[model samples]
Target: MMMMNKPNWRLLATAAVVSAALTACGGDDGNDGNSGEDGRPGGEPATSVSTLNLKVTDASFSNGLPVFTLLATNEDDEAVVGLQGLKVNVAQLLPAGHQVVGDPTKWQFAGDDSRNGAAEIVDQKNGYYTVTFTSLDKAQLDPNFTRRLNIVSPAGTLIDGTTEVPNGQASFDYNAAGAAADYTRNIVATDSCAACHGEGNGIHHGSYVEPETCATCHDGLKAEGGRTNRSFAVLVHDVHKVAAAEDADGHIQYPTELSSCNVCHETSAPAEELAITEWGNWSAVPSKENCASCHADNNHIMEQADSSRCASCHTAEGTGVVKGTIDAHLGEWNDAAEVISQWGSDVEMAYFADTDTTTVTVSITDANGQKLAADQVLPQIKRIEVLTNLGPNYPVLSYGAGSHLDAVSNGELANNTTIVDGSFVLPITGLPYGAEGTDADTAFSFVGLAACSKGNAIVACADVADPDNTDNYTGMKANMAFVTKSGFTPSKRHTDSLEFSKCEGCHNDNWQIHKGYHSGFVMTEQVAHDEEGKVIGLDGCVTCHTPDGTYAFNNNGAWEQKLHVVHGDKNIINDCTQCHTSFNLNAFAKKGPINTGAGANPYADGLYGTPITATCASCHSYPSAIDHMTGGTFGNGVYDVDKADAQLAVSAENCFVCHAPDVADHSNVKF
Candidate 1:
């Protein structure tokens, strides 16, 4: 790939932080100015002899009795002479999902004058108290249970002054979920989500959902991408991670914006429709009462979300929860050793089915008779195949060529060997070919791979024979193409299909037309467009089609379609038999190509090369007009943001594909 400009990591980091500030604390709607402790604007009950301030130094949920260190000071700033008679109490705000199903646990004090649920202060030094709470039984704690802490005095007096010293708040948000709090939301089951997040939809965080079903977004569904960007475990941690930067009150002073929770979630009094909104979806901004509903514990503030919450709900036996088995599997991959090896290639053999082509094929397998698949491998494996130099100058030759090679489907090449099989293929003239086998520059190449499945296409059974012994067997790995070294440069003047422009450079220009821009370019050339002057591309419709790929801009905002079906629909117009035409991007994104007839294209285009305006009119009327302007709300429901957002999850761009450059409205461009 041609080098353009290096990414400014600092700017990106700043932007991420800025985006996060938009949703920290919901507005305190319930905690209006008049509702203070004791139900007054301020101060304790009238005629109080002396005021007592109880603060917790160390309070954690280790064994129900949250260990706490306390400190008390009189109004005069003097150590009360009697110092031995102050009373104390500890309270906890039971989080949602963890309801009190039995006799609630009662508090009992440890000092001589202390009564059950009451305690006497002994010294002026930091006072320490451990309040033992009834541990949540398996029945009470939902695998996604979240709760908060509430500190109180022995006589049931609220510890209003007890805020964390560093941040000055005693309460903090705590989640039973893993490291992250539920951050992102999924919309698979709800028409609201399917309306926007399903297929042909793009609104929330890049629209990353999986399974394309209710489980994709609903906590009650399959529960995979239920919270925090879809992964419940990861979501819990990220939610509290905001504490690492934002303050306890949820203010982002440096970024010039108030902490606004509505930035991502949309909460309001939920409606009765199937498109109902939850406590999390109140408005573009949620009020503080909505937040305090869950984040009652001030301690969870400014600290990372506790992953221990995950263990609370997703234990040994729970559906839609991360089981212990999943954790163990992830750990195994985390601990695996990185392996390194060198191999050779054959140049004279056939790389692609067609001769004189710069391609190669290889397959990997495990000792098992069963084929290895994507789901079986740990996600961390970065296979490295080193290529040794049989010649000298070839090193420079290979390096110069590798930079120009872009495998449209796979990410960066991670291996160093060329022609992955033990053989190699030298180059021919008239093509971007070079002698790779001379020096490090020529002989080496690198190709990167993510964990896919465990079974090989040919492997029938595990070599271990016994299921328990499967871990002891070694698995096989192979590369699919000829890799050239990074050092290779163009031998003569060369130009890119986009004339030296990066994919992002041209793609971003027409971000709306392509639907999913600046992301992956799947082979969705045959995808369909709506019959209403909308821009439909493969990125939005490939959810069900690719199965493996995620999305941001979906096509119909209703049902997620597959590639073959989408492409076939575009070509058929009126005939049904046209579905068999040779469009392949959707399938290719999921499964690698076979040879030529019924498989993937080893080499795929980075852009949508062929124009299919004919298909554009199927859903959109021809001679697109400025419906929102000249006709006063004349365009499809897409051109208007509020209207589009109010409609079933379709984006304004979906209507812009054929409207602009063909119609007279620039207002959509303003959006």
Candidate 2:
């Protein structure tokens, strides 16, 4: 949600603390005198206060008398004293999925937020303050019920954390019984959502980024639109299933397939970062709130959404056909691991300039480093493929095309692939773009994979008993590819752009794409390598997805612009640091006009828009924004993108007047 107007207390923070300076020679002073040398105009001193940070030292509802002690600090980590108008909201956290009747035991509001707040304040003059709040009876306090204290700081640079500003709100969980409970509610971590939500402009109320923090009010007793619309699963499912804004609300579709649970949940494998303590709760703990989040209109599911009877039908002991939650989510993760021994592969490549051929060798071995038995494993090999393209910065290579070597798709040649010493050696002849002799270009060969589904017995991929389990996986993580050149020097262009590992922090394990394609999500290709030959994350993707390889099917923008558009549509790219390791290097600023598309090259209109304009168009595609980008007043003198020669239709965008050649600085780049 966007930030609303500032509170009365926030206005006081900005109020000038007047102090007279009589030693100034400037405009006429308020003494009704002429503009003379002695006309002293008061110079105001700049306030040193930045944003505020509060840490809860101790909190408890001991014996029904709620008291909270906290320490406040400014952005410089200096103690901030004499702070006032700091309010708090309290709530009770019930057990996960615990519901009475048709309503969830959500945390309703109490204290200053809901009632006439009467908090007895005590300042220790050392940034520490003790506030005794309205007392709650022992009947209101349950030892297992986790109480939440949300500190709302109104005396800071920004009370509502808008844009890049830090919102002065702090929350901490504590048991009213004055001790840590055995059953603490820890679902999604802050880092999990912070990568996409908090790191940008902060989600919802700006500061309440964590699910646990948001659950203080959003999930339970009272919500904006009741339980149906307020749960995390519901809001997340809806927003991801259909785009929220920057496009037609609910009309826009998700960038990738929504069926892939691995996009958000880390059930397939162990989470390396952003751990979810109750990762298994999604399937194990069935609730009406969970079921109805996605199956909104399903009356059968909606009826069961708010009750404790959800598991009665979905669990193993239930009479229903549906298996338990653990099986529903982790079933595939379990299926594949049973049969596949997580084998590894080694590859070698060499381009013989004399014969105009590129030979690639692939050796697959089990976890024990033993070669697979031909009769036992050859039948299970679903596909063996390799892809190649020109590198450094290929002006032609795109995701749509690849110089491929697939034994299954492309008919096997009699002398093409031969098993030599337990390794399959295949030589591909002919120069697609590379010139023969000393003028040869580099060949970047990347391996592709199509894993077979788990089976009781080793069998052909086509004859698998469970085809449903195969769709659970994606990517070409078989083995790293080899790069060879016939005197062709490689370019560092591939490794110079956005780091892929940064994206993996959110996308987890491997970023999946292309849906059910055999090589759905190819792992990082060795198209670009460091001096030590160590492969960075998905460096090969740049060889494709280039300026010319515009994935924008709507002719909206180039690949550079699309990345922003895709992430922006999700309302998460407000801050470049969300994905970029360094925005100060002008990484977000690409040169030249975007090749939106070309004539009959996937798109019919061959559109070309200005670079900076395309980046801005992602959020501001209105008529006024169009006028700003095209330098047209009321649509006059506008560059016609739909001209007879659309490729030559260049825009008269004046963004460069400020953007210039160097955008290495992060100063207000949003414009």
Candidate 3:
């Protein structure tokens, strides 16, 4: 292929040795780079290197030709030697005004013809690889122009212990004239996209790892044979639109507002304007076809070729025809002004216990500090749900106090009286011992109530009062307190590793999606006692997700496997620590129930016959995972004798048996 750089052998060798030595001595305690306690060079040779750190040692131009050298090392900072193949690709960074000409393929390795249909791996010594560009035109060189080197080492090439290194890459930039200020191409953070696509590598065909690298090749250019535009912004927007077109297996893969350019284009720069103008120029018209990708309604489509007509409706101030483009682009619920304009509600309550029933006296008021009239409040009251928190492994009980009730839906709490003087009484029957009589530990009560306009239903509600009054009157309100049972010791009972705020981050006000409730209420330690008197709620989830609680959907009674499958199927598996506390992650080695039944296989076949338990180590420390593999081994039909025997030998003390110096398959551990 056409070359632009040559290699510096001396510097590459020195870098390789230095990197290896430094990695041998442990540095970071975090999981990102450090493999585990076993990753230390002297502790135990890594079974396989899970990570590769690549760096450009030197770059210079010799006789109008560019050459560069690379050094590769593993997670332990050991040299990665004996790589079978290495592919080096380069993308030239153009200035803002420079127009790209010729087929864009010339900028990629796939189109380079000088290598005679074969990529070269030159000057391979230690962990260093030297790349030299034999043909580079001085006319193509610019002091301000930048170039990126993308190096890929194939899987199974760099062998360590019994593990074969998986495919690894290292990318870096160097200016042609060696000027420090020549490179400036950061547009988007890869981690932001990784919130969905996962960390590093991501889901974009593996090669397009980061946004910076993507921008290099996806310079608004169409592939040689493909009809679709390969521009980064347009391609991403269009692909997301395609994903939004249909629900995949009852889950929405892309957000509903995929076409709203501002959602993804909210950068401080003029990127949105430039992208839209380029999009129009490419299509030769701002037609409905392009506009309809995001806007399902064609009301904003331009009917004429006059470009000025676009400004009429798409301006900051809305036209007579419709709302302004910026205002209309903001989704229906996110507008602050619209939410604040609605009325709001708050609750006050007192609890008392009688021989047979527990009485809750409640009062409702509007945002204007006026008690709501009987007629104004009764029709809007959806239901008052009373929740009692029991101890660990016990189900929090819930009672629905309403006129309209489902006979099989948990216990019932009858509304004893209507709104009189803006107040009412709700009598709850069959409350648990802690809530009714006396118990050693005091129970907690969470009372959730929601009311909506005649035709509107509240889907999600906040636990605390809205500070800005924007969320009031939207649908729901709730109050929670600890119940002081008679003759009780007043000890705390319920607990959780995760908080409601984390769930609210993505779900917004609609966080209540589980347990057939759409009221946006957090269940907390409370659960609905079914007709069978079975407790169910946040605490109840653990009972079913544990080894002893092997329900049909328990996925072989392993909570990790079941959760991974469910979330993975929904395409939401990103970071594991989001929902898990640090302590929970540390103590994650407990083995759950095992099953060999036909339907007991929770993971897909792709996860079989590997060190799947090691996947837990990604979040949990490696030492913790050793116990899980060494504990009593269970079998489903998926594991063969060889795999089972291999796994059974693992122990907490001797972790290196599975995580040895040459084992590269550790991190590939599936479910």
Candidate 4:
């Protein structure tokens, strides 16, 4: 159950008409109105209930009837009443099968998500409720058998009763004796999905957050659309495997390689308790239903193995060299995984004076950290380019050919030849930024290339493949380096912060998303094994996607907006914690709006969105969602912008009023 340590907000919201104190929430770049004396927005206290936590404490099944008892409480541990519109379902926790990817013991579903009509609900109106499911087949069920009760309630009907909307689930298991038994179906945790989809922000329009809750009803296949039945394996595999898997418009592009199975079936996190159980079931316990979900497009192979084929060729006994599901997908082929790690970048841009030029040194080194000789790996360098941007912060106002140096300006520079001394010094001659701002950094991103080395010999990744490793021929991942305006001290910029390892957790260190241009990464550090043991600090991508114009990298404008828009379309982005280091709303509120590529920056000339709304719109870009955003009913704010109104707008939405800053708040659902 959740507790509302927060102050009451309705009183404060009622105090003002200008306040957008509705239930809807927007994203980052919040231009906060007033840090009120009471430490809340607009000097308000949040006493009104925002979200309710339901606990299914006890469950019992006797003969043909099953009963589930629950207690509902608001965030402050206060008893919550009046929560109606319950969609309850009971299912037996079945054993895993081999023919299909479903549990056979599950029986409560009568199609659709809810089992309706035959429930006797007894609400004491004091947080307790006894729900008995009638009309259950006596011979099919057992009171002593392990069973699960899934209580799903709609977001409203007041929970003293409710003030905000949070579609959630309260599921518990029990035997006839009211004791815990063998109900161990915890294969993947909610955080696994939350790591990408944001917790409680996806599936059934965000109604069900827990995977176990989903499995209770979804274990068996049911016909949906025109094609096959909708099972957990079928729906999930289709949504993630291909571009048009779920979308009719075919706009969704799977972010990582389709073969990257371990992205979801991850075995370990940074800690042991965080580790998942039975993760290897994806391969070990194969099923025909699981294989056909994604390989429906591969007609020939599917037809050949049509008879309950659990990809038996790749199973324990018969497959060729590759063994299981994990062995089927290709691994990273980044040609320079080693050399790039050893190299270092030294950038010098003297910017106290406007006319001063900058110099950059690339100290290419061998695996031993010594300088590389001309005869060494240097010949393997097929391609290399340096990218620069005015940083220390993001929404880069200037860079490239056509710069949008708006309200924020540091200095000016152009592409010019430079002279600096090192084993290999490449320089850009430009006037330094005038701002002597301490730690004001200039971002420099590098993209280098080398053939996959065969032992110590430099060989083209394609040619040297005793096995075909041509995917490595393109570009090499490189580290991002930043330097202070003093051009002497190194620094780091404040961009969209995320754990580099977290990204690697899915994409792996060899990910070069840009392909020909290189995806730009190789894990130099591991959060699971570090000295200080930090899990954050991986800021990149904004350097090329700045407003200064890198059309190749930017379309929806700023990195903040683009990241959400791009990923949101593919899978899920509403869960901010998936990529964000933390929800530092105070810092986010002070940030600026995103430029939707106006003035020859080529994104849809002169279109802009307010920071929070723009980022929210990145994913919630439907007409209905926008109406909720522009305050059609909630509150008012001019979020959408045109070239005429080029100025960035301040935060005006009331998203935070509903989405309190904490781990438990439904709006900011961070796992």
Candidate 5:
């Protein structure tokens, strides 16, 4: 996972020579140079840089000033000649108690036009350069200070004639006592930020590549605009606040709550304790404004109030109770139900294919393992439903006719009884038979809403309007049973890659994005049996997204690409590994180079019509893809001039004909 610094020059050069020798010879048809129908000459060798390596050869202190020498070379083991306008930045890492006071300066070299300032760069011929720090202030130096170096080339460098090499960085630690200083503790991983910021670059105008480097400049000081920028802790928190800023449509641009703390602050420590410590240090003292960020409804605290009021509910000793801020923010449903007598239900379903009918039987019981009487159950239960999964094509079928069904009015029951001795049997009509072959079996699940009734009415139920309440009486009974077909066995579809807990990590208890059912009750039959039969839970979604399922809309329903397109619409698709694991991305590549029409078209929207190799380079390095494409035949031979549009279209078999092995390494197809 480290950056690309070392490249094998010998191998690259040898491969280039071999490829040129092979191309110099004629083809099987004895055609040396011929123009195709598209007005492009065939067998034109691809010109690319074999290697571009930037390295720090040596570093030392000269008369209390730090000096370093850098070297740049190409694949032929020769100096990179005539490189100009190279910019280099040097920053000293400060200790925990210290802070930066002013903007640091960068050293630039333009050959003979270079100017000597606080830092000077001198060309030493043959790709070597000596840089020296001129003005050294002992007050800015410490026994434990470390230096970080970053070098970047101007707009274009002659690597493969026109390709530009990416920047590189190196770190140097200096100790006055001639010993190594203990490395500072990192609060957050760069990969987490790269998940949305595209490899840690292209964020904040590419000025900073890593968080440590960012801390050097944005260290709680006023910038050129006369506005003070807070420390990293405060800046990051305030920037991502749910109501911090709004877009033209009056919607919050970065709508994330503090409840999703684990998504970023995912240390080994308990998230609850980590959040308290992080926020406590950031604010120093709690304020009503801080509390109002997430708890806008709780208006008990005054603006001038200190941490004492917050500690009353957020600390164990202050309130004479064990509850704290964690318990208060997580909501009541996080813990077990308090009532001693709890209610539950068990359901069984039998289907009759000839009559297109399904018979459902339900039994009710209490926490003490005793069946309640029919009259007692009828008054406590709110509703009961039977949901059926009818294979891949058809949607799930729900048997609940209306909002609330009365025992006496709804007469689809056996013997016209809704509940008899805590049990009831109802026959529902118009259920379709299961599909043939692998999908011949059907799954039926039951849902019952049991409430703590007040005055013969179910009150304090769990609804979308008020989701934090624990008084909601909801229970699910999922049972897999074959329809009235002989020798039929039901099985689940492919294993899901995305976990429900992962979604809950950001969406919290309420699946707020969809703005309907909460994640807490997504698996229940009530939410799973929607009007469109859109399976509510992540587990149920795979049934409808199976190989045989209908997916004419949205990238032909290729789950991975469709997910990318959806997130791209929301401007969240930056790094591929954000949603997919490294193993998953490798597996996708193993399915062979994409865009050959083997699977559903994965390119859409932001990536629509993008080249196959260029798209592959989004997650992979350009050099690695060059090796894969040149190792063997790739892509279809037919290159559609209109289909390619702006992307490179070439058969893997003839990739080397256009892109020579050496120049391929420095191609501009990658991000």
Candidate 6:
């Protein structure tokens, strides 16, 4: 099963110290060592200045103090000595508006960041210096300040510098102030939003590139009498209006009336952008009117009842089968009825060109619940199609099946719930279903043969021939010829090998509704109709509700108590300073030798909790089958009744034999 391709052979063998080869050493900003090619520390002196790279350890805070780590290194070509006299200064910039809200004097600093005006040198001999500060009060620095640092010689001659670390832009909140203005007639430029958001992969989804990406579809010269012809605003507003359903407030608003600016505008790349928190439920998602300013007549505004209207934005021509979505059952031809005409309702027919030694049994029954003769059957089904979305006509038919297949039993066709066991056994041979021709060895290609047959005989025989034209069988399904190939291979065995049990772990139906809410999705049954077609029946929180659940019991007990009892009492002993922020503590924070906040669990330090796996063995590992002990030697709970007391007799310290506690702090204390 582990087929190692030639290109990956090196990855299986080489264990290098570094995963990537070293590239040219970019200019040292005094933060990098200036080692010469010979590897010795010898180098010509450019200057005695040293560079220090400083990084903030804290991520985000509304108004709390920030944490930082300072790393100092000699940037000069020569390794200088006597680093003990060096001085580092930290400062911040106050935006003009912020100056009016807070004291400007609080943003200034005097000496090194340390309270004592001294820095701890980890590798001082190597020009390494570090300092930590929990408050700007000590250095007279601003809490909201964003700026750089300057390292100077003891005499005040500046040695090195760094770029400014700008404060997070709290004023440009898309959800709050940004949407207050109505640019209904004028369009906001996507380029203006992409300035910082497009730093990495400037392209996202299909044609949405940086700058001109908005013009890919929104340049509205295609229509007349439109304001700001290419306005994405109109397109978004109309789209939301069309998608939304009636609510207590009448027509539901999208992106929230307050957060409408975030429909296409975001702080980061489109894919990674934050979703509007107040956006209504997906079922209540507004319609095209919200987006008409830009994508005016996209897909001409498809109807919701007719799910096929969604094809305009989510098909191969649209998104090319986005991950986590059921693929459209209609084959490459996109001919729905033509697809149903080929493979009939019988799910058990062994597709032809099968090289694997697996048997497939198909059965067909008429309305009277009686098996019909293959020869006498006309307009009978030969295969079943699974669809993701139902159009106005319901199940769009899938194509490509032939009349030459055996009629097995009436029992198999009794119900839709019964998955054909025969289909699971037959491993489809010759080009796996989706294999493109490029991968010859791995791809399954169709052979040119009439494959579907009664029993073992292909229906291409003389008796089943058309009465009018004996030369050709009109019963032949379209495109069936293209699939009959000799040398095609399968990517995955075509047998019913996709297991639902594996899905149960993440999509448990009983308790957690991760698979039902907007976080996930689930489809119920495949409903077949007359003229409307077949459609997958759907019902779930994600379809109609918001992040919250439907039932009141879930909202009260399980949501609050049971969930808290299960995941609460959390303990994360990783960082001591998170809870005790009167002192700074973070991954990048400079640390002191004192154990003042040592081993203090941050999660347990707070009131919230995190979820832990409820594996059977987590609480049960004892040799005995029955014991109430929380933890003991060899195990925690008894697995055997006879040995219950025996395992408990062993000292509690013995529990570490197999069940180990986190080394930092194991005491079961609240504080």
Best by lDDT: 2
lDDT string for model 1 (114-157, tens) is: 33232223342322333444332212323333333333332222
Which one is best on TM-score?
Answer: 2
- Report the lDDT tens digits of candidate 3 across residue range 438-474: 3313444445544432223332222224311323333
Off by over 4 Å in 5: 1-132, 135-185, 194-209, 223-231, 243-257, 270-389, 393-429, 438-516, 519-539, 542-566, 575-577, 580-671
Clashes of each: 127, 7, 24, 21, 8, 75
lDDT of every model, 2 decimals = 0.25, 0.49, 0.40, 0.47, 0.38, 0.25
Please state the error at residue 650 of candidate 3 in Å.
Answer: 27
List TM-score per model, in order: 0.23, 0.69, 0.51, 0.65, 0.46, 0.20
lDDT of 2 at 22: 14
1-671 in candidate 5: lDDT tens per residue? 11111122332332243233323321121213234312112332223334554545455555645566665555443455445556555444454333222112111111111232266777655566677766532224444565444455443555345655444322223344322323322344444455344443545544354444444334443442111345454556565663324455443334233444433443223333331223222122233444554445665654434444453344522244644544454333232122212554455567666776666666665665566665555543434444344542222322121111222211123234456455776665654555454343454432333343332234343222332232333322222222433335543332233333334433333322211121112233323323333334543442333222223322323232334444554555554434433122222221112222222422332122123443333334346454564344542222112234323433233432454321123232322
Report how far residue 295 has shifted in candidate 5, in Å. 9.2
lDDT of 6 by residue, 292-322 (tens): 2334456654334333233345432225444
| Weakest lDDT window of 10 consecutive positions for candidate 5 | 103-112
RMSD of each: 22.8, 11.8, 13.2, 12.6, 16.4, 28.2
Ranking by TM-score: 2, 4, 3, 5, 1, 6
Worst 10 residues of 4 by lDDT: 405-414
Higher-TM-score candidate among 1 and 6?
Answer: 1
* CA shift of 570, model 4, Å: 4.7
Weakest ten-residue segment in model 6 by summed lDDT: 167-176
Better of 3 and 6 by lDDT: 3
